[model samples]
Target: MKLSFLIKSLAGAATMVAMAGPALAAAQSAPSPVTLKGDVMLEKIVTENGVSKTQLVEPKVVIPGDHLLFTTRYHNDGAQAVTNFVVTNPLPSAVALASESAPGTEVSIDGGKTWGQLGSLKVTGTDGASRSATAADVTHVRWTIPTIAPGASGEVQYHGIVR
Candidate 1:
């Protein structure tokens, strides 16, 4: 698929919201104290000389079975620390989540209504049988940061494969 379309989809799916503390009470007209930037990278294996290494590079085109890395960087621009900050990202339709995720990360299979660990969630098939949800069924990923000090920055990342 075209890289631009993938980038656009990533941009639309990654949304920064759910702020707590004094920042929540700020005027709606004012800009958000937290700034977010999202990026999608293609994972490639390059062999130089006699050794092989994995690298992440900007994707100009992606095909099925290609591994990808999705990342979101966040920074607190507010004067005071922000607590209970949450970062949520939706998987693109053409991507399937990897089997493992960072500890404390939560995932949603039935849209954004509910979230839990991959193994803890279930999905009912069209045949009327319930089955355990797998990484392929993940639709969204979320991370709740306890606190972000003023001027502090951090990032969260996940892996996926093109469908």
Candidate 2:
């Protein structure tokens, strides 16, 4: 799908995923207990002067099969540690998960309701037979951070392919 179409369709969403980094977290609430934010990055294989190189750039125009990595960075700024901090990021239909990602991350094929390892998820096929979920079938990715210490920060990432 074209980027313009996605912007037009998702613009109606009430909660937009604004890019909020650690600076934004610290400014408000005088140190957030747990602040999570997401960012999108585009990577493509470019051949220049007969040398192929992979480049990461701001998402603009992406073609089918282009690789991408979606990442969410979380920070803990409260006076105490936070346990079970979770971050959930939705995958745009424009991209298909192309690889197994973050070790502790869970994938959802049924939107965001239920999630598990891709191999462990079962979905009914068009013919009404259950089958193992494929990476391309992922709809969302979630991670459960065991614990985050005060003023600590970390990031989780997932791989995807433009489709």
Candidate 3:
């Protein structure tokens, strides 16, 4: 299949070593009140010749210092316009949130129990030292989409670094 070849070709062309395939993409229940489906994805950032780029690849295997991206696509399958849509996603334990841009988005560090902007979050170390939460302490990501017309689709994503 074309998709299988594309994955393999991209894996080989990327010039990175990883035996694993893409991470398992997940779709939590649609944000309530909107008949939409959310799909998740993983992307790898590749820098070559000092020019960096990202490709849609799996994280079959990654180094602790590697940077990655987690994205979600939402499709409005209903016949009505959806408003005030919010999407939430949990980050994997292996990666910390990367300083990236996501308009109208918030993050959580307490297992999705709370949410806030990065500078507003704090992570406490075992040494009794409390410091501002870095990308590494991010445990979840959320996005608030104002509206999506019928038959239209939108996507939201955040970057992260492998721990």
Report each candidate's C-alpha RMSD, comma-separated, in the order given: 14.1, 13.3, 17.1
Q: Give the Å error, residue 41, model 1.
A: 0.9
lDDT for each of the candidates? 0.87, 0.82, 0.73
The clash count for each model shown is 0, 0, 2
Work out the TM-score per prediction.
0.78, 0.71, 0.64
Residue-by-residue lDDT tens digits, candidate 3, 1-163: 9999999999796754342223222234444334444433456667999999877666677777776665677778777888888887888887777776432459888999999987888888999899998766778888888999988887777777777
Model 2 ranges off by over 4 Å: 1-31, 46-53, 102-104
Who is ahead in lDDT, 2 or 3? 2
lDDT of 3: 0.73
Instruction: Name model 3 segments beyond 4 Å from true.
Output: 1-61, 101-104
Q: Between the candidate structures 1 and 3, which one is better when assessed by TM-score?
A: 1
lDDT of 1 at 11: 74
Which window of 10 residues has the lowest lDDT sum in candidate 3? 19-28
What lDDT does model 1 reach? 0.87
Error of 1 at 56 (Å): 0.6
